[model samples]
Each structure stands twice: as C-alpha cells, then as structure tokens.
Target: MFLTGEMLIGQQSVTGSSAPISAINPATGERLEPVYLGGSEAEVERAATLAWQAFDAFRETTLSQRAEFLNAIAIEIEALGDVLVERIIAETGLPRARVEGERARTCMQLRLFAEVVSRGDWLDVRVEPALPDRQPLPRLDMRLRQIPLGPVAVFGASNFPLAFSVAGGDTASALASGCPVIVKAHSSHPGTSELVGRAVQKAAAQCSMPEGVFSVLFGSGREVGAKLVAHKFIKAVGFTGSFSGGTALMNIAQARKEPIPVYAEMSSSNPVFLLQGALSTRSAALAETFVTTLNNCAGQFCTSPGLLIAEKGALLSSFVESASAFMNESSTNTMLTPGIYEAYEKGLSLLNDNPNVRRLAQAKESDLPNQCRGSLFSVGAKDFIQDESLHEEVFGSAAIIVECDNFEEMVLVAESLEGQLTATIQADESDLGVAKHLMPTLERKAGRLLVNGWPPGLEVNHATVHGGPFPATSDSRTTSVGSAAITRFLRPVCYQSVPDMLLPDALQQSNPLMLKRLYNGDWEV
Candidate 1:
C-alpha cells in the first residue's frame, strides 16, 4: 500500500505546493509511492509559528493529560501492527520479522515514555529547605526543575524507519516532554514515514492536541533539511545517520545565530576483542557467533562489530576458517536499500584494493541482484593499527580480522581505537585479569561495554546508550535510544521566590505532579 505526505499542522493534514518524491522498495527495487515534499521556507516558518503557538498551551498541560496523550499514541502505534510493519519492510527492503521487531520497539519506546511521564518525576525537580541556624543562613528555599525546550527538529534515519523516524524516540521523547516536533522524513522511506506520521496525527487529534504539536516534512534534497535546522524557531535537533550527514546538520545547528544542541548519533566501528584463552576454549562457538554477528541484518546495524581483534594462534585461525565457511553457506542476503547495496559494493572494492588487506572470504557470485552476501578480511595487528583508513566504518556485512601477536598487541589495538558505541569482550574467568586492565582504556574509548556478545541488538531500557564520542555520536552526554533520550528534549530551570501557585508543577512545594526525583542526594519515589 502506498502512502502520501500531507502536512500535519494544527492536528490536521494540509497539502502544499511542493512536488512528490518517489519512495522505493529496496528489496525489489520498485517504486512504492510518491510522497509530497515540503513547500518553501515560508511553509516551514508557518509550521514553526504554529508550534510556538501550540507550545504556549501544550507546555502548561497537566501531567495526567500529557500521560494520556502519550499513552494514546502508543496504543495507536500498536493498533497499526502488521500494516505498518509490512509497509516498512516494503519501503526499506528489511525483512518482515525485523520490521515487526522495530515496530514493537517503537511502540514500547512510546509506552515507556508514557510511563515515565506518568510518574512525573523525570522532570527531576529538587527542593532544599532553608535553614536559619546555619552559619551562612539560607534566606530562601531552593528548587530545580526541568522544562521543555520548545520546538524540536527530528531527522529520520534511512536504516531505522520506525525506530528513528516520525514516531521514533525523538518524537516520543519530545511529545512526552511537551515539546512540539517537526520531522524531516528520510527520502529513502518516505512512504513508511507518511503512514507513521498519520498515526501520530491520529493520536494527537484523539488527545485534543494542538495542530502544531506535530508536523512531518518530506524533501528529496538537502536544502529542505538545512532550512529546517537553520530555522531560529527550532530549539534542538535529533538525528541518526551517517557520520558525514549528522556532522553536516550539527555544523548547521552550531552556525545558527542562537546555537542549538543537535543530538546526532553518527557512525561507529563497534570493535570485538576475542581473547586467546576464550578462542582456545570454544573456538567453534565463537566462530558461529561471529558469523551471526556479521550477517545479522546484513551487518547494517550501527553497532555491528566491524573490527575483530584476536590473538595470533591456531584457535583464532580455526575460528576464522569456520566463520568464513558459515557465511558462504548462508543464502539469505538482501540489503535495506539500493543505496546501502551500492555502498556495500564500493566498501568491498576498496578493501580488496588495499595492499595490506587480504580478502579472507569473498562471495562466490558478483552478478547476483540483491542476493549479494557479506565478505571477510584479515590483516596483521601492525597493519590494522597503523592504517587509519582501517578504523573507518564500512556500514555493511563485512568484518575485519586483526591478528594480534600477544595480549600487549591487543591492548595497543584497543587503545588505538577511536570513540565507539560499544566494545565487546569475549573471554572467560582467566581473561578477567586482562579485561580489568583493559576496562579503563575501553571505558575511555567507548560509550557502552559488552561482554561475550555482539552490539547490534539494542535494548530500549534505561541503561541503553546508542551513542558515543565524536564519530560514534556528535555528543557523548546524549543518546538517541532509551529512556535517557528524554534528556535531549529538556533543560533545567530554577525558580526562586516565586509564589507556590505561580511556580511550575515540577517546582511547587505541594508536588502536585508527584513525579520521581532525587531529593537531598536520595531517590524519592
């Protein structure tokens, strides 16, 4: 089924003068539908004005009312179910199961934020009573509260249409925080984004939300996206895509007269370290896991293990052989988009041409359509660490094996790594000694640390951090996935000497919202 774009403003769908952009099915390379691109700069300004108008009232919405709105959005998303999943699969060329999983994750994230808002304390307000007996007598009570940052600009990611697009984390968190959203749909899967945008509008209308509370813009060119970020009305931005693309948006945000925070999750080479002892213990098991990790979703995941560090030994050799054999035997190979397919082809060609890199395994066929499979490459630790190009992410079903001469070489390789989303360690009890020594260095290099597992499957919980430093993410303190994501949509504000009734719900002494908070260094329920 094809879905077309209709501007969602003031809780309604409005047409614009912008032409249509074709949304293609990556799996079959067929055009699914043409979605309407957004109109000129004036339209964007109008939308922003609407959002600013909505924010005046929406920000004052009671916690219970906001909770109901968010919960309704979650329910609407769940109700879409298979229809939404199939559309995502058809548009993005992802498998049905993967799309369904993302849909569930998207719904879960919405519901999670709903629950978080329901509790009210995510605002994390604190109150300290004044003391007259102290040497430096406190004259007044002190309170801290978190407030919405006004309109948010969200850029949809090509890889995760459901999880990072219209109804994705950015929208969910922003709405939950009472900030209006204007999403710039990814050109690759505009159809899916349109459908999801409809769901968001449905939820908004059902909850009596303002028309400007949510808006979705479609554009084939970068100009529209640039204009959205550069707009003065936009208070912040949320993005998930390639390092170059995210960085470009960040540059635009930074260049603004009044700079805004751009929480952009860029690229990362999630490295996997396999200790010699673990390899000796369960080389076959390790090989099977490696194959699964490399081939999972055709290795398109941002957290996919792109670099594998292993000690030079017979076990490591056997693991590589088994992994290559398994990958060759696996028949399932379809990319999410033609752009991804082309990128994969170019990355493989570049690796093949590298003098220091050896193609450990190549797919048997090259002329195949979307049936193209992943490949494996190996290089000595000296070469892998010395070549800066080797550290860059290829964004495909390819793994680079770096053979280290000893534990020290492994440590050196680990130390040499740039910022990463995750760094995995496959080891047993004996390897803990080395892990202990490496943990400090790894902690400095990565945002998340994993043990005996891969990093592709991200959990949408409180602890999950889908971000890292620099290349992994534009900022280290923010994440694009998980409950912590709400932080990006909010900023703290302190009110002093304000009347109890005049203060925000978060700062009122009555604690009318009853939200959770950290009170005097203690967690208050």
Candidate 2:
C-alpha cells in the first residue's frame, strides 16, 4: 500500500535509471514526495518481452475465467478505499467529490467490461457446414471467430487520472478482448499511477493470470513511449492526450517495420449550436446553463462546449449579455498541472490579442496558483469561417461564440468546423426544420450528436461513443469507451476444413460456449 517510485514489469518492482520525475500539487504549487525515475529502452524491452510471452495463454483463457479476472481487478481497486481517493486528490488537485466519483467510474468501467466478456458476444463467431453433395464444387466447412491482437501499449492522460489513467477504459477494453496491456503512466501523477498499478498487479497474481498480463512504466519524456510503440512485440496502441502527442505516437506506430493500429483520442472543441427558437423562449435560462457547462471542471473535459454558434438578433444579444454577467461572477478553479495552466493562459492571450476576435466577458482575477478563470469571446461568422486558427481548440475554460447574420450563415459556420467528439443542437419544436437541415453536416463532422442538451459529462454504458474523426482520434470506426471498445483489440480469423477435435470451443460443432452465432447464413440462437 506504500508508494515506492518503481516501474512494474511482470510482477517485479524495478527502479528506473533514467531522469527522475516528481509530481507537483497544482493547488498550492508544492511538489509531493517519492520522486519517480524514468524508464529507458531496456525497461521497455523487459515489459514487451513478458507481454509477448503472456499473449497466447492470456488470449486463450475461457470466457468465465477472463470475466472473473476483470471482476477481480474491480474488487482490488475498490479495496484501496480512501487511500486511493486521497492520493488522487493530492496528485491532480481535483476536488474530493470529483475524485470519488472518478474512482467509482473507474471501477464501473472494469465491471462493465467484465459483464461484456462473460456474455461471449464480442467474439462474433460464425460457422458454415460442409456441403458434401450440394451444388457446383461442394463447399468446405468454415468457422470464424475474433482473436486478440498481441500486446497493447496504452498512454495515460493528465485529466481524469482515475477514470482515464492506469486502469481506465482503454486498459479494461483491451484486457477484455484478451490482449495483454503495458501502460505508460502519465508523468503528472506517478504516485497515483503506482498505487493503482500495484492493485492491478495484485489482481493478476490472485487470479492466477499470466505474469505480464499488466504492467506500468514511468517516463519523463517521449523516449519510453516511442521505444515501446516501435518494439516488434507491441501489436496495437491506445492513447489519450493532445493532438501533437497523439500524432507523434501515430507517426511512430506507422513508421515501424510492421505498422500497428493506434487509437489516440487527441482534440475536440465539442461545438454547441443554439437555434433561434430555443434562444428566443429561454435566453436567460440557456445562458445560465451554458455558463455552468462552460466552466464545469474548469472546462478541461474533452466534451466541454468550447464553440457556440447562433444567428445575430435581439434574442442572441440578450443571451450574450446574460452569459457575460454570469461569467464575471464565475469562480476560478484549480487546474491539473502548472504546464496545463500556462498553456491555458497562452490560449486566452491569443484570443485577447486577435483583431478579428472580440472579448465579451472575463471572469474575476484570482491570486491562487494554477487556477482557471472563465472567459467568453465573440467573432463574426465570416471571420470564423476564414481563419483556421479560430477552429483550433484552446484546451481550457474559454469559449468563442460565432455571431451569424442569418440561418444560412449558421449552417456555414457548422460546415467550417473540423472533426469533433460531439456536436450539440439546442432547438425546440419550432426549430425542427433547421435542425433537420443541419443534421447531415453534423453527422459527418462529429461521432456523437445531441439535441436540446449540453455536452460536459459522458455516460459510461453499453451505447456510448467517446471517439470521433481525424484529430479527435486517429480512428473513427472505433470507440475508446463502452462495450464496443473491445472490438479495437480484436481481429477475425477463419478456419477452413479444420479437424473438429482441434477447433476452439466457441466454434465447435456442439456450440459449447452457447454463444449466439451465425450458422449457414442463419441465426443460431
């Protein structure tokens, strides 16, 4: 239960010989104890070797066994209790309630994947019997099932240290798909990562899993991550960070002798479209909720409404005035790290200095270290459409409103956006026609679309999408959260005319696993 600055490699605790790294408490600007040293290519090799060794056995585990292993991870994480909560709060400077909620979400994701594994649905098995006496050139018996890609390399994110770090969605889904995982812990919260890493280590041991089923490594820079991605043993990757960081990993993965898939969730502005009818009836109320969503968690959420589009009118002016009043009264919030705070300040300055952009509201100043002050800015639709810099994400509690001359201009503004994680439409019954007209563009621009709702928090469930196109993530066909995430680590293999005795349990003639499969082009319930 004690924190020791070490890299976890196949159940062994080894200290890194590279540069040392320590966490800083963003709230008070004080550095915490237990400095974690960085790992090099040597450490990456050890973890990669062990993971490759464990892949075959781990991937062939029975459905019940894999489900039990996932459940055990949840149990171990919950067993950490208040120690986990406190460490998370100190390392990230997030509020106590937020930390606790994130812990619950982490465990919830594990259990959810556990259920996903037990159902045997992700295998997508199929079988076709041999037609010995039939038609032209009799068909050979065939059976197909999804198989796990080898070892996976996962990179953590600065925000959501618990829910999106050590044992977050990426790790859970990969393990569920029967892939071994090697996590590259985020530098901002090494102590917290170490604590949760130990929990996973204990779970693997208790469940009698392979030694390298899970491991965590620390590094200050790109050396460890880059080396891991380039290693021949790593088959796929899962990453969550900035656009530059994600693209860097993608480049490494693609440049390898044998390229691998990298699912990296990078950037998103999560634009919100305010329709004319909705603004007219509830401008004051919409302003209140908009400011609330804009400043939630200091607006660090990837789903935060960073862009708002509306037609210029008396109603839109009223909405802006009310939102500015609320913004001035908004409280300053502590960010996760000093570097993140600095980047946020720089983003605000760019908007403040731009001639095409007009600053509408600025929150009260704060003397506290690493705090975020809410900001609101506005620009004409033409400027927003012409300037690509205006489309870039700020990564903090700053939002830009686009004032359009008419509905046509609003539609044009929507078309000008890049790929996003989510696109929200605030509309009423009267605005249904406009909403319908804009649906096709929004569908292509984002992965998830919302109506009459804000985009701040995400629900972790069976039918949730936490991914998008292009810069939002490297791959749009897959999601980084929910049950479908298991598909990312899986690829199908078909066995033709294989001996019945040698067939896998799921694809055998007797249907031993009781999975719902496609048989002879018909459903086998």
Q: Against the true structure, what is each candidate's TM-score? A: 0.96, 0.99
In candidate 1, stretches whose alpha carbon ends up further than 4 angstroms from where it belongs are 132-138, 366-368, 516-525
**Residue-wise lDDT of candidate 2 within 1-50, one digit each (tens)?**
79999989989999999999999999998898899999999999999999
**Candidate 1 clash pair list:** 10-211, 10-212, 11-211, 121-515, 121-516
lDDT of each: 0.83, 0.93
How far residue 42's Cα lies from its native spot in candidate 2, in Å, is 0.9
Q: In angstroms, how far off is 128's CA in candidate 2?
A: 1.2
Question: What tens-digit string does per-residue lDDT give for candidate 1 at 69-150?
Answer: 8888778878877778777777777777888888888889998888888777678888765555767655566678888999
User: Once superposed on the true structure, which residue ranges of model 2 sit more than 4 Å away at CA?
Assistant: none
What's the CA error at residue 244 for candidate 2, in Å?
0.2
